[model samples]
Target: MNERLNRLANLPLRENLQGLAPYGAPQIDVPIQLNVNENTHPLPAEVHRAIVEEVSAAAVGLNRYPDREFTELRERLAAYLGHGLAAENVWAANGSNEVLQQILQAFGGPGRSVMGFPPTYSMYPLLASGTDTTYIPGVRSADYGLSAHDAAEQVKAAAPNIVLLCSPNNPTGTALGLDVVEAVYEAGRASNTVVIVDEAYAEFAHTGTPSALSLLPGRERLIVSRTMSKAFALAGARIGYLAAAPEISDAIRLVRLPYHLSAVTQATGNAALKHIDTLLANVEAIKVQRDRIVSELTRLGFTPASSDSNFVFFGGVKNTKAIWEGLLEAGVIIRDVGIPGHLRVTAGTEAETTAFLVRLEELLTQGVNNSPS
Candidate 1:
């Protein structure tokens, strides 16, 4: 912890939060950063120019507060989704994290319980704690696959107010089939539990993989959250939104702060929508690198899970921290996701991917951890 932050902890604070550390991955300044799941591609110039012009127009209204409803932004997002969803079913926020926090605020506050499969997103528990919701950890397979049966069984057991399902779950890139979503949603209905399907990496999923948004027609308690931070290459712009039934969107509005979406944010997101095609052009390239990494890593004797997202999670790591350190020292960085023998790395450009595999191979050949016994 930073010395200054440590001293500030001495001040008055909530008891539950007294000893809790903030959540974040290492933000190291590495030459090739494959840690954070950010789109390594540069922004498309067409989209960049559009954003500049639109934001400049928004700047003219700097004196006025942003639209409280952020109506236009919602409509733009709905159009992008194009599953017969309308603005009434969409809600926008600064980031997917905030969108989740708002959901917890509305449906998961004190006395309510929230449940999620383990080793998913690290933020679920933190969001629960921040909102005074009790966090229940559910079980997944050793490889992090959650079966529909187990999902329903756990939901029935916990009887939580909110159930979070992470498709193409973080730390491991496994996506849930629609059967799993249907099972879990059906299971939750008995307790009136709100089921949240987080699809932050959905854009990177293989074609024909269904989104939870498609299952939203009659499921009122289901909310599917997404972000522009990943495949859209707009992490710096900080736009995330969710799609649900109109009533669920209404519930989020009750908890969101007034004028939460700034005019600039609305404008930037709208402009990005105009060029969604160009912005998402790198997704296929990323998928190529992702698949390449999986094949090459398997050939090198490491066990990598089948990935539908932009990153790969591999085990057979004898020492995760050791491997991570070796990569960092070689000017490449990957995530040590706290799984004993596992690490995750985002798919970057072709050159970056080759650089990572070459350096990792060098480390392995040198017998950093793996050795021919």
Candidate 2:
């Protein structure tokens, strides 16, 4: 056997994969896919035209490798982020996932610890482990809000090298208020630790929820990552970006792969950026849909989180799995969060939301009838 293979062959694979599951969204071919929080709108014609034109123009460059720096996209992203810095403060990757991985590589590793609050995005712990960093959790308060005092205590006690936070956090649609984020940043800065805010759903946040980017001017240790996936309707284009101080961005750039983003992806992302107005309009519509779903779910007797993201999370229903299964059987699919009796449903188009509610009503009625009197 090869020496490296022989050295690894004796090790248990499960040990490396502890506390992680295979990562993927569901693949059901349901007509109404409310499972993943993808933007339900298709790309508008103008955006589509621009993407096609840009990609076609770049097609001749297939003979050469893409620009390793992705300079133009960086400039465009910097402008989009609206901080005073230029491309020096921006880094692009295959997706926000890669952006996150680079952040972890730059700041987290063996013997160092990374911290996060749970019932947030599921990826933080996995990313920490992939970078060989110790993963620590500071579970949120029972109300799904971050306890800044507890977080500060944890940071002081653990002294982790990196702290990951998600605003308008995933799976729950709850946001870390700016005050809490600033408190976390201060704690991390005092420890010489890096703080990363994952703002994948920032566009959908309720008005006045300050973006961590708004707080980045004087902070050297803070990084805020954003994606064109959710609100931009470009999940398939795979463009994720980071906004940070120049030094940190440079460190992230060093660890990322050369040509980390393809020429086509850069072209597509730029085109999408040009249509930000239209995209935000779609986000507005989705917000309306989200509110309707929340109110309807409440009236249906399920308790939902006061979500500020593009989805709603509700619980307190009996037979959660049965309701989920029933929805699937009815050709509507929503996410089954592992939290007992809780499930998440993404805001879809008006038609899709109507279908989901209709199916949910059926499930509720059936559940009541099947219950033991």
Q: How do all models score by TM-score? A: 0.97, 0.94
For each candidate in the order shown, give its overall lDDT on alpha carbons. Answer: 0.91, 0.84
Candidate 2 regions exceeding 4 Å error are 1-14, 18-20, 368-373
Which number leads on TM-score? 1
Q: Give a tens-digit lDDT track for model 2, residues 1-373.
A: 4676666666676464654555777889978899889998998888899999999988889888888888888888888878586999998888899999888888887878889888878887788778888899887888777877877778878788898888888888988877777888788766798988999999998878788898888889989999999999998898899898889877876687777788889888877777788766799899999999999999988899988899999977677767778889889999986777788999999999999998888877766424422
Residue-level lDDT of model 1, residues 143-209, one tens digit each, is 6899999899999988999999999899799899999999999998879999999999999999999
lDDT of 2 at 206: 85
